[model samples]
Target chain A: MVDQLKPGKSIKDTYVFDLKMSERGMRINRLAEWLNGAENREAFKSDMDAVMDRFELTGEEKKLILDNDWLNLVKAGGNIYNVVRIAAIFDVGLYPLGAQQLGMSYEEFLETRNEKGAT
Target chain B: MAMIVAGIGTSHVPSIGAVVDSGRQNTPEWKPLFDAYEPVRTWLSDERKVDAVIVIYNDHACDFSFSKYPTFAVGAASEYAIADEGFGVRPLPPVKGDLDLSAHICRHLVYEEEFDITICKEMAVEHGLLVPMDLCFPQQGEWPVKVIPVQVNVLQHPIPTALRCFKLGAALRRAVESYDRDVNVAVMGTGGMSHQLHGERFGHLNSDFDNWFLDKIESDPQAICGMTHFDLMEQAGAEAVELIMWLTMRGAMTPDAQRIHRNYYAPMTTGMGLITMQDAA
Candidate 1:
């Protein structure tokens, strides 16, 4: 979970308009470059489908998707940084949560990993 | 004559410059974060008037691997290149290494101090060394001083204890002081304030622990001198507690010294902190 340093309600309670553009901001640019590629675009299309299926998208997010308006996602408070990073990582066949998400035993994952490598 | 100038402790986070390039530093949210380091960069380059720097940092699964990792590795090469780090080379000048001075220090540590450290004749200095150099010695086309990089094995399991690192720094001071050449040496210990970059706890940031760490490093390093790996990992983030490297810098300085520059910022899951102390003598 993202460690929220404060208590009480969320954004509406502590909304600050201070936008932070990171020097490492190129991560998004690079991700966009890949997302434009045929292979990455294909992968992201499926991942987007999975995200839509798994999580409830905000009304604005759904409209951005329906209209194919990429910038609208940012306006929805869904920072492109998160979307591009998660998508890129998924495209690389690497899951951020992995089996750990299910709370599965690491030993079982190790065995499966070894079996996959042997194959 | 031997003259130990000052001690510096700073974070060598891989993403600092990348964060800046991403335009984070320009925003009001992160401008104060970047502004603090401006003085640190100035002090290391302009005021120190340093001829040589002794850098202490650990490699992150680069250079040496888990197969057979040495606790302490000292470079004896005339010149070192920036490490690849599997991603790509960073934009920076080739790091200049002082071969003669490194050799003398190695010999002194081995023979006089009876300390056994792995001698590295051909080793590429990683971003750990490069980041600090970039921040401290910017503006100049190249660094004005030569470098001596001391690689530590803190990534892998069963790494050296905090006390061992402290003693190694003390040994390093003797090695520098014994050098026949008349050169002023500055020691830099690079690592963490409080951050965990890998695994599920990846974005962990502990500013309170980072500030407490900065205070302890200056006033009573002994508080953290002999901490166990488990203890460091417990209080400090797993990836963070590596601040044990600071003990080495503290060990290099005299018992009493005035802390000149100190700053802390937790812009992005990593507590970017820096402290500079003038030698008491």
Candidate 2:
């Protein structure tokens, strides 16, 4: 079905945030969405286990968030937007998360951009 | 009667807002992208005389979370607050909205064109909408013109097709023309040229596809209208499929609208682009 959707070419390394992914990552996304509010963010930061239990996140989902394993999170169906939200809680940003996804050191990723140190 | 003065297409990458807020426009890393907007600011404030802008952007799981995400939403409020997308809220002032114009468009879209959009009484706009405002009209203290935000669902699947977005733009033109006010409205579509922010292809950037898209949007938007969402994702990175929003801006103008200005820059993960068009007199 995914191949049928692509008319001619295929993006090898990208994960499209479609319905199936959304369904699979519903619990993780919900936990991330709750971080939008200040109080919710504070509560999650204070008691990570209780918050994960409250959101009914699976053991694997909790591990993904705890490890800052962004690539695995995406492979486990977490959207990048939501994953970034989760990453922000630990002060990890998009570039660092993306570097981890590409299996490169953050420095190697920066060297690839036109503006290396801008971020 | 109201008139459509101009239509604009821009990329609303969140990092652009950070650069503007930090006062780093002239810096070596950011000069090209920021300098390109100088002419745009002048044209908007002087040449176009746009009294209100219908900003076509998408919500990035900020205001409208996935729990109750609407496919299409229209802001009918008099003012919209800036949302805090994971980070703290931006230091920008609240956006002023033309409630009368918004209500009229809402009514026209539903009854006249049969596009049922969710009407938002209180909506908080994220960088998707505010970044465009900052690029075109840097808020000295107050915004130069009012805005009506039309948010689309580009994140989740079953998003509106390219052709449907084009038809919605046509409907918006009719809605704006039918209004009895003496307003000069500019339709602004903001998002994407080519970049994906997920998986192994986290920083995908396709300048070739983006430049071709810039040309096609001006000369033959119909060519774009026929492309499937998957086709766009494959060629222009997955997240770049948000280019569908640009069709709404193009559809708001005459088929032979004159292209006035065009710019493209791929500084980072996203292919940031800018284009302006005016309806032929």
Alpha-carbon deviation at A114 in model 1, angstroms: 39
Least accurate stretch of 10 residues (summed lDDT) in model 2 chain B?
B62-71
Cα lDDT, all candidates: 0.64, 0.90
- Number of the top lDDT candidate: 2
Candidate 2: C-alpha lDDT: 0.90
Off by over 4 Å in 2: A1-10
lDDT, candidate 2, B1-281, per-residue tens: 99999999999999889988899888887888888889988897799998999999999998887768888899999999989888888888899999999999999999999999999999999988999999997788888899999999998887888988999999999999999999999999999989888888878888999999999999999999999888898888889999999999999999999999899988778899999999887
In terms of lDDT, model 1 sits at 0.64
Expressed as tens digits, the lDDT of each residue in A10-115 for candidate 1 is 2221111112321222233333333433455566566765445344544555455545433333333322323333334334212222223224443454443312
i-RMS for every candidate (Å) is 20.2, 1.7
RMSD of each candidate relative to the true structure: 14.2, 1.8
State in Å the error of residue B213, model 1. Answer: 1.0
Model 1 residue B167 lDDT score: 82
